[model samples]
Target: MKKIWQLGFLLTMAFVLLVGCNQSETQKLSTGKSEKTTQTTDKTATYPMTVKDALGNEVEFKEEPKKIVSLIPSNTEILFALGLDDKIVGVSDNDDYPKAATKKEKVGDMEFNVEKVLSLKPDVVFAHESSAKMVESGLQQLKDAGITVFVVKNAASFEETYDTIKQLGQITNQPQKADQIVAGMKVKVKEVQDKVANVKQRTAFVETSGEPEIYTAGKGTFMQEIFDLANIKNVVDDQSGWFKIDPEQIVKRNPDTIIVMEDEKYFPNIVEKVKQRQGFDSITAVKNNAVVKVDQNLTARTGPRLAEGLEEVAKAVYPEAFK
Candidate 1:
């Protein structure tokens, strides 16, 4: 069943790319005279700027996009970290990190309200790659209305995430700030890496959501990379991306620790559920009660705060390292 779903998702990915292609064709207006590639130079970004976005689409900005709308929390966090708070005209309903973001006009939930986004009259809108599949028509409508929208790709690793952050900084005229943020992240991650180097690696079972669906992060996902940094081995590392796991399989693997990435409120009770599940009772993590809680946003969102997430994972997986 998981294989079938994975295959379907791969096929769907092709269609999603095509959606971006179609939008690119419609929205790829001339960015004005092409200038030399000075992305490496330390200077204020010049406009009529043109850059290729995560979706492999060439997006042009006549000038620095001031009235910006971010349709995702990750992008919103990056923008705020770059000190573009005054320029952020609107944000998604899920944008809650900066607290100031909460004061911004709410466009909509994950599936953004096209009407609300347009009413905000943003010069540029930051979108997620999933929007290609989830709100293709709304995205098309936004493109047709002459609005510039850049759909950020789903970063599978931390390196890719850093590149996206740099890309955002370039387009938003904050390249220097982006570099500083990435540097800080690297320093923090290095601190955790150095501390966990001597610890014995533990096999971990990481749960992304509550049961019934029973999803866990697999190979090629950000979670797996974070686990690796923490000197923890994922039980489901053999699979790719998020995949469903059967209780029997989990018991067979018998992970040494279970890390729950949901709200803390779900703990103890969810821990009980894991213990009650047939075949899961005999699992080492269940018998030893080694379940730990991690914030969902830290592990999930691939933004500036990802370094903090990596540190949290290291602590959760190996509490002794922190002490």
Candidate 2:
């Protein structure tokens, strides 16, 4: 009887140990699943979110936007970068990047088509602060039609541009993608800055247009910020904003470099054109053939490519440093 009781006790103890092992394994799997769920939740934006737009108007989002319309090229570029191309049912006429945007429905250029946008039946419309006043009545028309319109800020600097991207990401349920885009931009910007950190600072003139009236970027403009990042001094830094400057003033400044932001498609041989300008022949940039033509879209559009623009400007200004 003693031997039988001892054996029974041993059997009971073994059964209890086996049950405990099974429970331990089950708990581990449960914990892993819980962790994965939390991670996913953290990456997604919650709906019924009300956020203030650049115009200070409170825009409420009830659910993830399935259909989107971008009224500006910069906004369209941001949307495409966030992998929301499928959701973009309409884009402004000016949106020509990503090659895919051109295939989307065309809204009017500076003057967006309210009827066309309505026809698309977008869940959200991304307008720009720059054209808000110009399209006020039209935007109100869309609002009256019970459509959600969010006026994105005109991003004048890199930081503002990053914020614009993040805001778009939040509304589209692409917060993770936005963060990733911004982080990548920041890294590329830093890399360019570090590359030119030790280079000699050169004076440059950024010409937005050439011929009839010369338009150059000055203080408080996006190109000014690009100049600052690339370690190049803007000869017209004293002037505020973009305006027509006398060609003689450029002669007086005699910048070490002349960076032209004209599209080759519209203005072929733009660099040569700059060199051929009257009295510009004596300029230092023309003498040294330092006139460089950069992609206007890359530098002008405050989008993901702005970092690439910075690198181009930096390399143009200091080619030796990059080499």
Candidate 3:
């Protein structure tokens, strides 16, 4: 009787051990499945993001874009700044900065070649407001081909410029970087502002184009905003937007400083040209030899480098501040 009782006890103990081992294996498999689920959730993007571009059109992206094409130089600069260079498959002919852009496949300027853009298989294409207008039909066709096209409006103010940068960052999953860029720009602009705080605001003229017809920046233009930030009053602030100013009108304004956009091919020796303008000799800028030549791209392109233009203008307008 004692031997039979011991055998029963040993068998019961073996059964309990076997059950515990099976449960352990099942728990290990469950844990592995849970970890794999979490990883998959992390990799998937929350999609179907909808945004209204500068043209007031609602644009939607089904998923995060992996390939892109920039139709304007400003957009290209913004993309490059956001560290999306590898994603940019094509750029406009005018995209010369960041040097790397020049080597990308060129989709025709102004009027984009839909065929070339399609051949690159870009998930999204950025177009300027003017360029979109120029190729509305082509854009519609691209949209019909299931391609997403976003038209960036011309940013006339610093706030608008920041909005564009942030919007692009959101589209590309780099909003943090976008914010950093804008913050850096703000800091630089504030530094310039601080340097010119007590300085008296002077009247200045921005010569956009010269010769038979003189194009100047007026109110609601980036140049005017830069002028305002630099503690200078735009001599043509009375007019609205970009307009041609008669030589006689410029002479009448008689600005204290003249900033000419340098385009050697079109307006070489622009400073000398301004000095020789019939009746411009009496102007304060010419008399003081304050005809400063600035890079056209820096002043004109509404991208990450705008603050640099602002700083250049401040230094040009007030040399004593730096001294």
Best by lDDT: 2
lDDT of 2 at 117: 96
Give me candidate 3's TM-score against the actual structure.
Answer: 0.83
Task: Estimate, for each residue in 142-218, the C-alpha lDDT of model 1 and write its tens digit.
Answer: 99999998888765556766777777887888989988998999999999999999998889988865666676777
lDDT tens digits, residues 199-245, model 3? 98888888766777677777666666788888999989887666668
Q: lDDT of all predictions, in order shown?
A: 0.76, 0.79, 0.75
Model 1 spans > 4 angstroms off = 1-32, 38-42, 263-268
For model 2, state the Cα shift of residue 270 in Å: 1.4
Give model 2's TM-score versus the native structure: 0.85
Give the per-residue lDDT of model 2 (tens digit) for 1-323.
33232223222322322222111000000121232211211366766666677778867777889999999888999999999989999998778899999999998877789999999999999997767887899999999998999998766578767777877877788879988998999999999999999887999998766667677877767777788988999999997767678999999999999998765665689898889988999998899989998887787677999999999999888988889
Ranking by TM-score: 1, 2, 3
**Backbone collisions counted per model:** 0, 0, 0
Cα miss at 180, model 2 (Å)? 0.8
